[model samples]
Target chain A: MSAAATPPASSEESTDASSPATGRIPGNRAIWVGILAELTEFTLMFLVYFFARVNHPQMFHEGPRRLSLLAGSANTLIMVSSSYLVARAVLAMRQDRPEGALRWLLAAFVVGAGYPVVKFLEVRWNLEQGLTGGGDVFQMSYYYLTFNHLVHTGWGLLGMAWVVVRTWMGAYDAKNHNGLVAFASYWHATDLVWLMIFPLFYVMP
Target chain B: MTALRKIDLAWALLVLFTLTGVFLGEFRQGGFWVVLVIALVTALKGRLVIDVFMELGEASPVLRRLVRGFGLLVPALILVTYLWGPLLARFNWLLE
Candidate 1:
């Protein structure tokens, strides 16, 4: 059924946790526990990046120049776009349009999948340019941070795949879609991490 | 505005801000002010993702604050480290 055909959501009718008007958790509490852990892990990693940069100002300044600007920019675009699509998918579900939600989710998965590919090419190019994990402190931090983020993104991509299958099977709808919402929260958190990482490594050097 | 339209707006602004950061980084020389501006931009981007994309604006106060604190704290830390990095290094040396 199209969202256009569904009646507008009434406050009296939406007493559930998923109601957009209420000050409720977007997903379940468990996923938030995981999100907090993820945030903590990244915060520690960011501290490491800052510490290394402080100690090696010259190397930090030179690092971004040696890297491929296009790769970094492309990934940033990919991440934001993918995040937007997933968000749209959730909104589509909220609108009670399962087919629309599925379409948006599949689009998000395809875009999110590009992240690993771009990262692979970027790493290969870096290796060709003599930027290895053992090269210097800057390279070490870059590899450590970005690769960690890549791993998280890999998890998020897998989650997206699972949710895609669920959506196809009519497992989610407007009222009881905690699974989808939890996955969206997770994917958004991953995207948030990437936004911070992008400037730290590529833009700010 | 419709919720979807609001998210669309947030997406547009996110892309615009990202491009702005890249432009500044590419064109401007590294300096105290440039570092400060970049840090601020990073903070703004983080807030957008939290409040808009994550849809945490109306959640529990503690949960909202915790995430928002992160969005603000990291950039503040970045700026602090940028300005006082040498001093921090010395402090570390002293501890060692």
Candidate 2:
């Protein structure tokens, strides 16, 4: 994202009249608006998932077994780890530990970058197993839902890259990290979506 | 005891719950209770992220409620459909 588009951490410093987080929204309000929109979109998609499952219980039952448990399991671990590391990053920055925060953020970006790589391989594996989006109702929903999530994750990775640059420039400090917090909020929301997606598509067997 | 340590603990618990969910997904005998257990775990993991990582536990009431609702919406719906497939299916005609 462009610097012009991001919420100013400077504004945060001037506006915080009480305690640090006395009347804050946690992150930028603009980002929360986006998060709300994204969550609503996913909620509707989830309803679509259940609709298909209701119409095809057998496919729903058998579909999860066909997926690579190893692949789904790998992705799950990576997503949760990435979220954890970023949460720590926020905590580190808040404690005036920029080096620690940067370290954790770098670690998070690295782990987060793994999600797409694993998904690419998982897509290949699915293809090798003769599973395509058009395979069946369950497979169709699976492909669309997960692929949409992959796109969202791509957005998150892009945002994280920007955060990396800003953090490298020493733009975020203990008292002002609104941009960093906003980026973390976005990534964590994406993580939340994947958490739900994993269970709905991969686990509820 | 510290908040940083607490975040680590939450992360550890999230990983543990995820592995448990996957284990049930892979090796379970497959029944109603199995699905319910997975759903409950999913809900717990989602709430932890919202409360701990998102810093929404002490957030304003409106923001907290929104986050909490977003976290639970999908899994709750899934459980509803899973446990009451036939009954829900009967209302499927309404959509059409």
Per-candidate DockQ vs. reference: 0.51, 0.48
Model 1 lDDT tens row, B1-96: 557677999899889988987797677477788888888888888888898888887566677888898787668877888888888877667545
- lDDT (Cα) of model 1: 0.85
RMSD of each: 5.0, 5.4
Compared with the true structure, what per-residue lDDT tens digits does model 2 show for residues A68-154? 878888898998899899988888888888888889999999999999999999999999999998899999999999999999999
Candidate topping lDDT? 1
Candidate 2 residue runs with Cα over 4 Å from true position? A1-23
Q: Which residue pairs overlap in candidate 2's backbone?
A: none
| lDDT (10s digit) by residue, model 2, range B7-90 | 788899999999998788778557778877887888999998887788776555677788789888877887788778888888
Scored by DockQ, the top model is 1
lDDT (C-alpha) at residue B83 in model 1: 81
- Report residue A81 deviation for candidate 1 (angstroms): 0.6
